[model samples]
Target: MTDSGLEFDLTRRIGGFILRGRASLPACGIVSVSGSSGAGKTSLLRAIAGLDSGLSGQVRFAGETWHDGTCRMPVHRRRIGIAFQDTRLFPHQSVAGNLAYGAARAPAGTPGPDRAEIIALLDLHPLLKRAVAGLSGGERQRVSLGRALLSRPRLLLLDEPLSAVDTARRNRLLPDLRQLLLDHGIPALHVSHSRAEIAQLADHVLPVRDGQCGACHPLNDWLAAQDASHPFSLLEGHLAGHDTENGLSTVRLGEASLVLPGLGEVPAGASLRLIVRARDVALALDPVPGLSIRNQIPVRIKGIRPQPGTAYCDLDLALDGQVLTARITRAAADSLSLETGQSVIALIKSATLDPAQE
Candidate 1:
């Protein structure tokens, strides 16, 4: 996950709403653009693709300038491919036909996309002969991705690609999407409001807020900072192991074993970050016996801090070198005799950890 080999600084004012942001994307893997609704996420993507005209600023790719405040490049001239939430594949075409459309439209002298490679990369061989209208939501998305790949664009933009699918459908298609971006070495700009989508797929996080581009960090750090409005903490670890049949994984955090929902094909030792909401964790003075809950990490209370208007107090736990924040009612803290330096066990469930927190 490196930069997109491009630099962008653009500003477009549409009436009272204005979108002003800048980013330096690496040449490899995926970069995510995230923010609350109406925060210019979509407009930014459109501007880069040349779909939104009148955008002023610089859009530089490689060493060539694409968009300067004074000059605008037409959409067809830019070597960028985009896949929107609708995935508008031609209704009369088959899966293969749709992909071929992209190949046919590719610029002359450009290295045409290998049909076999596109088919295999997206696992679309099974549906090649199927009618486009008959495809499932996940299947449609895969075909859409294949079509985009066949276009041989220098940069790919995905706008909330998974928002239309149900959870089961998303899970079914995620592995293919991951391989498409990683195995194929495709540089992409992905836009989404869903934290989980950004967490699992993006390495570089670009947070857009109030029509401005803020600091960029690894996906995990960005998510942790989001839940500060409530009592929650962020933790990052390696994907130690997974039980596909059960859809769970044993996550390694320092010396502790934290099992959570399995992220498909997350290679062993792959870094995984989780958001542990304050309400999901329980504190115990001593280890309880015969518990089905999986996470029971030894914690030493650091201190308690008060949040305005809330009856609960934020408890800081020293788990290895990382601090875990927990929100508990002040009454519960006093009843359990919890205080600074008190030895305790933090109880958590594998189901409670949100993958998007990463």
Candidate 2:
């Protein structure tokens, strides 16, 4: 089969740090680049975009050789749309002017959203005529994103795109950003430090550690490898129905079902992704009655991992072939004598379930 994704084995040296980035990322969907400060995350991105002249080794995208032992492609020739943390908008131009410039430079027959669609999607209609110098940090980032989208490049690279936006605004924009990528079939490499962003936006995770970028992993596997403090699992389902009276929504996942906070605005039968935190799940030996918790799923114990020197243990559960995690005190595990293959009830409070656009 022909390889249809990004493949790179790059090396660069910045000051005293030697950076190595190596990965084979999918051709579609969002891939999050995660790492700490000074870990070469930005450097890796610059190298891929052909901005790092000192970069050495191979870089290929969808069978196209961007960089090789002796040949190198120019940045513009690579046809990538990039939004940096600095929000590199043209200072002298109005918001609309910057957006128009991007549109004008788009290569003929490039496939993506049109100018009107992008302006509405990013809520840029109101700020179209405003000068770039007068915009707020969040507004600047939004404009930067709008410009990039208008270009309709084959690949998108975002470096902390939403960092300047407030939590509430960021939460609302994330879904729209994800939908845009999916709708246009634009593959992206998103660099973010926010766990919520990763959970909501990432289809695959590329970890940068100790100045090296690692191979991409599925979202579930990446979450499993995280520490207890970041224990989260993703569940995919379709919205089955909604109860307007009680303000709740029902989602169908295979043979299993879940009750979540009212998502009435979302049409019935729409696909949804649910984020469940391990700490919010309670385990019980038997089904309890008359509880406020809305979801009581019958799951079989798959495995147990005890956190050393900590009071808690993470239980891997199987519910109709889907995996759910529960974190409870070690004492509770001993008292219940939980064992592999034992069937138990997993209690989840409906309010704690966060639904994301899929």
Candidate 3:
């Protein structure tokens, strides 16, 4: 295995089912796994974590092999942080005690967050004194998340840690989870079935099908192939400035600048990744102003995919270097005479951003 990031090429059998997968996780940021139930998602994570001995082949990360036919690293020595759907907290431990248990496992001399930072990032201050047994599902997951981070693991394996939390708390905590991963800068493999979750969090996505790992795609391309409701694209940019009076902020998308509807208090010059839904993007042959859409960038059509069972097509547009998608009716496409290699303007309303996805 090349020693750049996390690599796995393995074969295993469980209950008469054969699983063969090969992938190299990105050196940084979240690389999420999506698959159906009983499709070997958890088994893959378990193999990487050294929790499943039945898996054969190899697992390597950060220039070291954790497993092979002749050599294996103990789970304790792998330096991985794992948070499953199950909280897995100590039955008798207080919230603080459980977190301490994780911090206690930190590898000597490796740099990571101290107790205070973990507590604040996951908003665990209120539950520090509470027993793990008494906390609500969301609260317990927070503790689990904190515990995982405190361990100072070089790799993180997350198995739908948000599945148990209520919808209200899930929405509120999504941003926190994004920030925590972004702040840590370690490579994390998140197992999830929700396309929204994958789009909201993952930089690179790997699709697992019938026990095999498939090619990885950027979030934008993955979502375009999804159903009509999931037409979205993520573009990386930087904050240009803010308009406090009008509640607007300017973001530079490649070569152009967009004045978005209020991104409260975001400082200028900070790198930002913005999410835009394809349905919200309207295409035009020429730049027109004065209506209401705040963003209109010149984009070249790179590719097109007709959305099955619908009258629309998804246009893969390249704006300078970044890519975005536009979902418009086929009739609209025919009327405008759109095709690959054609240049046009992509119009977007700034209000479509849900800050949580940023």
Clashes of each: 9, 0, 0
Best candidate, TM-score: 2
- Which is the winner by TM-score between candidate 2 and candidate 3? 2
What's the TM-score of each model vs. the native? 0.71, 0.81, 0.77
Could you tell me the lDDT of residue 1 within candidate 2? 16
Report per-prediction Cα RMSD to one decimal.
5.2, 4.4, 4.8
Q: Looking at model 3, which ten-residue stretch has the lowest summed lDDT?
A: 349-358
lDDT scores of the candidates, listed in order: 0.76, 0.84, 0.80
Model 1 C-alpha RMSD vs. true structure (Å) is: 5.2
Candidate that beats the other on TM-score, 1 or 2, i.e. the better one? 2
Ranked candidates, highest lDDT first: 2, 3, 1
Error of 3 at 10 (Å): 2.1
Model 3 error, position 134 (Å): 0.7
Per-residue lDDT tens digits of candidate 2, residues 1-358? 1477888999998889999988888989999998998888888889999997888899999899999898999988898899998999999999999999889879888778999888876789999999999999999999999888888988999999889987666655676678789999999999988766887788999999989887689887886677546585677666789999988889887888888874665556755567777887899999899998878988999999998889999999997768888889999999999999999999976432242321
Reference-based TM-score, model 1: 0.71
For residues 1-358, write the lDDT of model 3, one tens digit per residue. Answer: 3576998899988888888889877788888888899888888888889997687999889888899999989998888999988889997999999999999899778787778977875678989999988998878888898889889989889988777776545544555566667786767899987665676577888888888889877666666565546667777777788888888888887778878874554456655567787777999999996777767788899998988898989999998687787889999999999999999999986433342333
Model 1 residue 89 distance off true place after TM-score fit, in angstroms: 2.2
Candidate 1 lDDT over residue span 54-161, tens digit each: 788898877777889667777777878888877888989998799889887677776635778778655688898889999887678778877887888888899887
Considering summed lDDT, which 10 consecutive residues are worst modelled in model 2?
349-358
